[model samples]
Target: MKRINTLGAGCLARALAFSLAAGGLALPLSAQAADLPAAVAQDLYENGGVEHWLPKAEKGDIFAQYVLGHMYCNGKKVEKNYELGMRWYRKAADAGFAPSQLAVGTMYFQGQGVERDRDEALDWFTRAAEEGYARAQSNLAALYLGEKGVEPDYEKALHWYGKAAAQGHTVARYNLGMMYAHGLGLDEPDYVAAYGLLSPLVENGHRAADELMQSFLGEMDEEELVAARELSEELQAQDRMLVALDQRAANR
Candidate 1:
């Protein structure tokens, strides 16, 4: 597979100064939670509405700003106002809150309230990704994989996917597996790698992975199936992916 050029001009790696952390990955978030940065919004909103977060957001609390942003954007006890949401998100984002950055990037990507700007979206995603935010990294990879204004950049996509996958991001791992299954950025599809990457997810009840496997199974022959089983067995013995993550973090 073609690797992303980290040193390329205007690449997502412009924020590569930060090093990966050495630690076991957190338990993966549900796909829905991974897609949006509002996993905590409901809980926060239930605990207190906009009235609770307003003063703190104004006091320059990034967490409060983020919660306030979510409430406004989601119309939780307040009218939906993308502009107000963006305003609060920007405040926290400017202060380097990863979730807020993801929120702002998502808004830009979706053209919510603000004019849709792919470049701006990429910028915010890159910022949060630099902070080792897995969702931002996954979103960044998706943008690089396919976006209107941005040309498909497979190397960049793979790079960010690996970064996010190393953090136990299900969506990133699924996307990376799909790319391999289709031979994208590679000489040919590698069923072993693809199946190995996805089988665990399928076993874990990822409906999408199970659906994809329906198509993929027809393509793999007996020998490939054997290889895939061996890969699975090896994973049970030692997690190669986690080791790779550790090495990358150690190097950093």
Candidate 2:
């Protein structure tokens, strides 16, 4: 159903951008070594624990390099050194660690360790996204949506967002829902699709999703509401099946 000029000026786009940015997805980390207790490592990390991991990082341990980079970037176990952070992140990224690639992309995006280069950020994010990293996919979508230093491209944004959303990325789900709700770049709004995308988020206590759901419900008539509810159930079932399939594939 197309609702012409129903949304306030830039309202939907701004909401989508704010929700994505506010989600605050953390940088991914590799699993801790089975031999090394998580508590001990956490204690070390919080209390200048870089000494234990520095040797390993120097010896080309990707996990150690990532940890060291994170510590350096946040000044946890060492003085804040964005250059060293970038160096360590790059080492892991070059070794094909998806998390480190995402981190490096973020560094480039924020000008933390190097010049702020949107192109560099795009490159790193693309590498990680190609490897099926959901955060990187979402970030790449955001970049294409013009949240970073790039012109907005709705088609590219939708492609990347769909990838991330299929992987259960919360921010990407919210964004994709809003895009459907407002027909941001599409010829017509799809309220049923928006409902399907957003219903689970509202159930899970996402404030933004809840607000958007309220707005959506307020705008629809009884017939549309019934149709949206039915569509939402179908979408949820499909999502469950996909997750099950992914789990089975991972176990193989």
- In terms of lDDT, which candidate is strongest? 2
lDDT (10s digit) by residue, model 2, range 135-217: 77887887777774588887777777778888777888888778767766566666666787789889989888877777767
Determine which window of 10 residues in candidate 1 has minimal summed lDDT: 18-27
- Local error of candidate 1 at 128, Å? 1.4
**TM-scores for candidates 1 onward, in order:** 0.72, 0.79
Candidate 1 local accuracy as lDDT?
0.67
N/CA/C clash count, model 1: 0
Off by over 4 Å in 2: 17-48, 221-223, 237-252
Q: Which pairs clash in model 1?
A: none
Q: Please list the C-alpha lDDT of all candidates, in the order they appear.
A: 0.67, 0.71
